[model samples]
Target: MKTPFIVLEGLEGAGKSTVLQVITQWLEQRGIDYLTVREPGGTPLAESLRELIKKDWDERVSPEAELLVMYAARVQLVNEVIKPALAQGRWVIGDRHDLSSQAYQGGGRQLSKNMLAQLSDMTLQGFKPDLTLYLDIEPAVGLARASARGALDRIEREALGFFERTRARYQELAAADPSIKTIDAEQTPEQVKAHVLAVLEAQWPS
Candidate 1:
């Protein structure tokens, strides 16, 4: 049986990681064969790139540079991690994927959508999530949850307005694609997990 490819996407503090953990446990209980990984840092090379990208943000870093680096990391991750795992019939759960670039770079940075699409076409070769669970939350609420966690990183430190733009972009993508399911993340963790499980059951009912 071919493994299902699942990707979890959302803005910072939208409970992406927590939901990931819950889904992993659910899969484990079902004895589902799977592997979990995250974008921008899945492979060793990608992790190095991740560090570079996350290190103190530079106002000098051009939007193009940001986009290139993200795709570069993604290319490496696909070649080294995602492709191989799926080829072996292991379901792969990604913490974040290409939609992130669309939200953060194309939307947040206000880059040209044409350029972004062209780059994605050239690099990703049409790889996409079979199911994408998007945890939707208000920018202020999400940022407050993030702030309570700890000191913000370079990307995390971006203004609330930036996250608002990112969140809106996520909604637009979910609206455009039926494969993407939006889940309200303002609820408790257990409630959010239940919503995700229901989505998976509906999509992959046996």
Candidate 2:
């Protein structure tokens, strides 16, 4: 089998940073050659798009514009960074992936799911993560945690209802996809860590 493309996904403040550390440590101990990359980033063009998307502008940003920019960044990252890394037999770990666009744009922004699917199929050509660990948390709780982390970015500053819709779509999609698994992010840190580790070990044991 090809080297797995593993992705960690969740709303803001779901402890993905902590989980990433755990994953990296585990991979390092096993001497696994791996590359970690975040969506809307991991390359010069993609990182620039990330900055452009995050920076607040004076005028109201349309949902269509946001969605297009996200896809542009994603395509750049996939072509420039992710695919080559995987082809070289390196484990690719993504902080977020295409699923985020489905939830945030299709569900949160109320865009048509068919349009999102068409774009996904066209851009990715059926590429997908081998294993996606989705940290599930209530929007209110997650937003509260995010707010405490300091200033919110352009997307992060959306209304609570937006995140609620996003969370719903995440749950719906995770339930339907066998490769995606949900971890209860409301648990204590230690507990959540244990659950994450357990899932990781189950899917890709040493």
Off by over 4 Å in 2: none
Flag regions of model 1 displaced more than 4 Å: 57-59
Which ten contiguous residues of candidate 2 have the minimum total lDDT? 197-206
lDDT of 2 by residue, 17-136 (tens): 888988888889989999999988889999999999999999988988999999999989998889999999999999999999999998899999999999999899999999999999
| Highest TM-score model number | 2
Query: What would the TM-scores of all predictions be?
Result: 0.96, 0.97
lDDT of 1 by residue, 54-122 (tens): 888546677798789999999898888889989998899999989999999988888888998999999
Clashes of each: 0, 0
The candidate maximizing lDDT is 2
